[model samples]
Target: MELLERLFMGSPALWGGGVAHSVLILALVVALGIMLGKIRVAGVSLGVTGILFVGIAFGWYGMNVDGHLLHFLKEFGLILFVYSIGLQVGPGFFSSFRKGGVTLNKVAVLAVLLGVGTTVALYCLTGLPMTTLVGVMSGAVTNTPGLGAAQQAFSDLHAGAEAPDIATGYAVAYPLGVVGAILTLAALRYLLRVDTQREEREAGSGTDALKDLTTRRISVEVCNPAIEGMSIAQLRELALREFVISRICRAGGEPELAGADTKLHGGDRVLVVAAPRDIEALVALMGREAADTPLMRDRKMISRRILITKSELNGKQLADLKVRSTCGVTITRINRAGIDLVAAGSLQLQIGDRVTVVGPELSVAHAERLFGNSLRRLDHPNLIPIFIGIALGVVLGSISFWIPGVPQPVKLGLAGGPLVVAILIGRYGPHYKLVTYTTMSANLMLREVGIALFLAGVGLGAGEDFIPTLLAGGYVWIAYGAAITVVPLLLAGLWGRLRYKLNYYTLIGVLSGASTNPPALAYCSEQTQTDAPSVGYATVYPLSMFLRVLAAQLLILMFG
Candidate 1:
């Protein structure tokens, strides 16, 4: 029993070691939480949120952890999480505001307003403390940033008495917030009698404009007499589609690399790289398809996906880079934000863009170095922009704007300030010579680590008092939070479906975005077996995150 307690609880001797036992406990909670999170019930999982539950259990068992250490880890984890998200979605954030973006954002904003209204109503009906309601509001929306922002606001207002209540309410409400969003999706499907197949078809067709570029390479014989004498540039203009003529082979000569000004001759074969649908038009304009000849299948030539990781290469035009002239490699296509774009001369390269370069193997290898294709480099976190962003966020969070008749000035707080700054940096970092890209593995690691630390901190802080509060009418906060989670989502989803005629998949995405619930988004994507939910989710996520944080802080300012 003594050994078991020492192993599980960590004795004072363990605590007095160079590394405190608290650190060990925190590590255990995080590792166990991650493993437990992978266990799904009916296709639903808590994901990284399991860390909170683990921490709660440990805290409830009287685990003594360092409070300052927990606080630092929590806030730092939150910064890393939000900053990574901002970078991941930054490039597309502004573009998502265009076209149907206004409508999508409006609907998303309305949904957030509905949640705030629901919170207010619950407050009036239950007479719950404002701090608890604010926490519930954050949890109900499944937005950890909002919760962090609200806590920051509480701290700013010197309301230390209610701080623990915020964590307690949030921890209690968060699980239902995730489940409630999924349930809202299910309820809407049943209530609206949506046809899954029909919705999928409509969503696919209606959102065709949102489709990523699909590229294909084909060899076409230039038998068309009219275009035979035309330059490669002229043929490209005539085709009226985006494609590149990478190489040309004459009737009895070697397959020579082709440039824009290279002239096409009748019976000559050309290698064309273009969008799948556009390939047909080019084929018809060029001539019949041909099998790969010996020259066309040159053994020395190769293709490789090279990541653009160097800060020096970012924001430079493809023509300016002169890889073909210097390294003998041609960039056929560029993959950015899950879309394939033709490597036009004028197209600028951004950090994280993967360019498919085709050339001699040695030349491609050289090009890889020029493009900074070091996996180790990607693994090393770029600390410059991260620390800069956090410093700026803290500064921004301190600035307050006074409004007439308001008791307190409105500030962006730690969460909002850093999030907004990260998004802007992510979008325009390349333009300003800032490298904001992180490898996918690194980004996910940072995000998971951050959320785990944050959740663990919150759980440890709330656990000691959680049981007593729950026994003393704290359970009502859970019911109130559930209502806050479901009512707004269902109302907005149904209204969007019936009135605006939104596709079911899209509506689900909007609900997920408005709630800022990644778990719900994951479920929606899995359930639909399509990426349609992602478009809607990405479209509203930035605005939804901003609004959620603002609303949480506002709720506290109004009712605290």
Candidate 2:
């Protein structure tokens, strides 16, 4: 304490140590974020390293932050990051809701509801307040928005009502949520033996594939025999015209911008982000052999949201918007107040309406300029249908509410309501497109950001109170966390078997425990030794993610 005081007590850093701590913590957080973004085992959001930093800081500093500032950081950062993801993934996500795809949708719906059902069942037994119980379950599903809806419901139930110790409960279990999600994935991997047999099986099928297909950036050397005498700047400008300079590698040299003024050496290599075609041009322009490094290709399309507000090209209609003409962009769909609006000829512009657009990278960038603004923003509209479905489901579940039940309503999550609905949709929705391409992106945006914000609220709200309460209860959270992971997993394993013909990959996807849908399809490919499951898996995941978010809210409400 004395040493600390001497170094920073009067160091002009803290308004009670605010400035210094903020800088340090923010930097620390950045490092941790980088690590998480860079590393994943199997298909897990294993952000344990980040969690540890937060946990250690929380333990030492009691997780202090100005409430308003913390809220702003958490909410805005989450929305920004997730909004981009939504825009990128929206169109594909929405297509999941269509006809001939209902079966996959059914599987996804069932898995999520099962998670919710387990939470409520456990909540009833413990007599825990509904909010915390619901929050934990929703977070487990990676759907924090549900917690938000639950909070709203709780407050609505009793004006100015202090929610039950949900924050505390979430704090105790979130780390476990991360771990469980990873374990679920690991279990899925182990159960299906994806790691051990993928290469061998593929080889047998005469399509040898690399397990580490995901991209990585690396430095390489390239020599231009013809351009050795040319100035570096000229080479740089030439390269820039065709390819993005990803990075540069020089002989005992410092890396700098590839400019028209820099001199080039025979052995100099300029790293670049470019397509194979661009790379060919770059080699030809350099007049020498160019080293090619590993390049990652995205199998899925990217998306973004264009908010149609007053600044959105001044009240243009869809066709009048000239969106495609302006940017080669396609209007996948539109959203208003959490409802999906199909792309139409006359859907006039309105402030705060989110238009989900899909196209190549350049096109998306152009659309954002003309439409993205300060007052409004784009988001995945997945929440709308799920929210509507859940609201309807819960109300319906409770319409014949019997007092002898789990608190208020019939427990549909435990049963097969969600899965059944998802499958029905996936199997039959070819014409329906419950989650269209645009809608998929919108859905991902909503679910990702909504859940993150809710979690931020929970972490901030519960962190301090959680530990103290846990000790008083003799630290029962450990057991509860264990139960949360185990029960749902077993259910998924069996359900996948009985419902989906018990294919190994489907089983693994069911068990992987995280919300990533692509893996299930991948897993199916691994097990059945075919690509057909990929289609089925893709069809269901977006729909599943949407339902998980929407249902989470109502489930939280029920538990609270």
**Model 1 compared with the native: what TM-score?**
0.78
Best by lDDT: 1
Top-TM-score candidate index: 1
lDDT of each: 0.80, 0.47
Residue-wise lDDT of candidate 1 within 246-285, one digit each (tens)?
7778998877667777898888988888765566678888
RMSD of 1: 5.2
- The alpha-carbon deviation from the true structure for residue 16 of candidate 1, after best TM-score superposition, in angstroms, is 3.5
lDDT of 2 at 405: 37
- Which parts of model 1 have CA positions greater than 4 angstroms off? 1-14, 17-19, 159-162, 205-306, 322-334, 339-347, 356-376, 403-405, 498-500
